[model samples]
Target chain A: MAHEEPINYYEYLRPNKKYPNVWCSGCGIGVVMGSLIRAIDRIGLDKNDVAVVSGIGCTGRMPVYMDFNTMHTTHGRALAFATGLKISRPKLHVIVVMGDGDAMAIGGNHFLHACRRNIDMTAIVVNNWIYGMTGGQYSPTTPLNARATTAPYGNVEQAMPICEVAAAAGASYVARTTVYHATEMDKFLEAAIRKHGFSVVETVSYCHTTFGRLNKRGGVVDMMRWLKDNSVGQIAAQKLDEEEKAAKIVRGVVCDVEKPEYLDLYQQVIDRAMEAK
Target chain B: MTETGSAENQAAQPVAPGTVSETPAKKKGPRGKVTVFGTWCKGCGICVAFCPTGVLSLDENGHPYVEFAEKCSACHWCDTHCPDLAIIVEPIE
Candidate 1:
């Protein structure tokens, strides 16, 4: 008997559709997106009850193609918009999508505050370092001295530690995964949705167009292999020195804590107001 | 697919690949230019092969560098995946 491959999430994607996935063939964003969809499926949420929100970037283009109640919002405000949407609806599965540039740079402030608030929402930040949409400009997540359009002389700025930022900002659940870690990513996203408060899933993704070109990284398959080998679990990652851990990717849930979500607190306020009336 | 539309449009467009296919609104600057930085040079040379403009060449240091800043289409193959953190595409601003 021939063995069958396990059911894949990519099957859910609309093949031969109008919205050509602007992402490159092996880009991690697609894998992350598929993992997210699988999370919703695993959680058994109705498609109508899920609202996928996104900011500007190639990752932000995701909501436009999804078959759910999605909103393609302004850059970096995806979490803020989803915050309001979740608080109002209370039953919706709100997911915010953002790219490295939109998440860690222009919309960076929003990201921190969302975690701090412990809002009842899920945030998926695809960190590919450079801005994939508007050519290759260096974003905050771009490694120091890495080349970008604005940083043609070489980026002197430090790359932000996204998972650390989320954990420090008080997110109840935080995790980091790469495009190459598909199984772990789906597992992480599934757990994030089950958590009570804010959750951040940082995906170390790839940009083969600009960052890849400038850096002379190999083709897509090679890029995936690089990500897989470089990644270490967050606990194992901590034991290594910064230089020893140089160019390494870190995956797995770094933080998971229990706290009342913002919506529940809002519900208490609403009940008090109703009693007064 | 009108026959008359073809002859009229051909005069308005350039015959070659780099030639103007459509009359763009911006005033013409120096043609296409690709800028690759040396610091990020893992030296894959995907840019040299992917350059439809055929303007990229390896520097003596073996990292891809472009001298003809005027002859690039800004396609960005060289700027995308330099594994060592070298190279970028920029207009001469």
Candidate 2:
């Protein structure tokens, strides 16, 4: 008989911190964390071989709970740190978790360049629309006309489609899924981790305490139901008219292509220079 | 709580190899056993509200429990949605 290891979710979690996470009662960050853990467990990755890095935000707290090579970097600098770490230790699987503001607003340049560099790293941007940790400020991903603490009347600027931006910047794997589609999010994360080049998985999360209360969205369940109602799979989305499609969040693997990763290319350049010498 | 077995009792059953399956097997036995870690549960009610077959419900204390194990198809909605990682679904032989 084959001896099977017990599947305990807590095994991946930090043993020191007792259960009952610090996030709000209905915050979706925990759900995203669960997806990440499920993905790692599904992939059977050795915890020592994995490194989880995060920028300062509610999402940044994600690494603290996980039993991995966790690093909490400065605000909006997770990608910069993760890039350096990935280049130095190419063997480790690096995952960067950032909130919307961390990824698109403060670290926008780093994010673009990281995708452009095509480095071997997976970025899971937990987009909760509003900056939940430092009070509800309007973020780069906040939908236009939505009410945030910063946007008392309504947000005038359009929301940034993170996957589209990553795809355009040349990320080899780019996918978008909401917290409501937890299974799909897990699969996307697993695929992103397995991919050899830079990958981006934008998890459309909800800040129920801030974004929900400000917008009068009932609660966590209501927010989840709204996600379910508003989202459409990419394939199915292709059939809808422009007007119809505009209202729905396109969820699926947006772009996936094989590309030469930065570290591997750099090594090849060094090898060529040595051969020439 | 009266209807379902404890985690130890459930652990005694044969273990399934992977995370909860997306597709339920067409087997005739009980779909699977779901165990909730009471302390870990934050009373979000996500698992209870989203269980497609209505297999889970919050007890008086707000922790979810398998209210109807027979109806559980092992679809894993509760397993995936539990923000606290409080629930685990295992296949029963």
Candidate 3:
């Protein structure tokens, strides 16, 4: 008789998918994907009822490896595609993944409206600061004075604070963490998925090959260590003065509140129309 | 698989034939078993750098070896943060 292989956590991955996933070695997007899988498993969610959507970029390729209802949509339109999916089948748990450029540049409008509409979906923006897929172009979140292929001298533009924008745009839940803080990332992701309305989890990652090499930041180990030394927790950030806080990446939940979801509100309108008829 | 000897030698040399390298180890451990699927690993070194108890270390070729499997806290940190999903920290019976 043949021996049985014990079930492993990696079963969440598609069985026939090729190994050594598409991301570059030590890319933090993989860590974010891992956190998402762990969060879904912990929630005991049925894979059949979950949908993973992504747009064009390095992070966009994630849904291809995941064993769920997955959609690899066009550039900067992941949330738009997710919106349609959520409206048509409100019961499905929709998760969208996008890179910094995909989310904040091309898809910026969709991102803001998704928050404003209070839709029930979880958006995980894996921000590596530079456009990793298209060969190190400057992204909206690239810190001021950072070097990219486009910004050879230095990036003159200020970086966009993703969590702040999400909160300001009216997302029900907004949280931020880095790839180095994997445990905290898992918790924040789980919370975002469970939240009732639009939620955003910005994972601050590093693009070692493109961004790091261009900037002369060290290898993957050094990049990972940088995340460890630079980031500050939300509460601890409060204690630090302006100068100290400015240098540290603030991590933790920025905002979370109960709100009426867009689909639920639309359903009430449908009921009212039916009554009138 | 279950690595039972000094970890330094294992890091310096490649895995010898006839040693459990392909399948998950069946050892019964108080903490758990740490399995590395060699083929799937990308030699990223994230697991090695972030392991809290110094349980993993990179080999000569950059792949991680279970340097101190006994020290693994079953924290699932290595497995969860692995970019390739190559490591599994399973609690053995």
- Each model's C-alpha lDDT? 0.72, 0.86, 0.86
In candidate 1 the C-alpha lDDT for residue A225 amounts to: 65
lDDT head-to-head 1 vs 3, winner: 3
> TM-score of candidate 1 restricted to chain B?
0.49
lDDT of 2 by residue, A147-184 (tens): 99889999999999899999999999999999998888
If chain B of candidate 2 is superposed on the true chain B, what is its TM-score? Answer: 0.64
List-wise, what DockQ does each model earn?
A: 0.02, 0.30, 0.36
Q: Per-residue lDDT of B54-87 in model 3, one digit per residue for the tens? A: 7677778988877566555566777777888788
What tens digits encode model 1's per-residue C-alpha lDDT throughout A6-58? Answer: 22333444445553355554466766776677678777787788899999999
lDDT of 3 at B71: 58
Worst 10 residues of 3 chain A by lDDT: A1-10
True contacts kept of each: 0.00, 0.54, 0.60
lDDT of 3 by residue, A130-173 (tens): 99988999999999999999999999999999999999999999
What value does the lDDT take at residue A134 in candidate 3? 88
Q: Candidate 3: list runs displaced more than 4 Å.
A: A1-7, B1-30
CA lDDT, candidate 1, residue B72 = 53
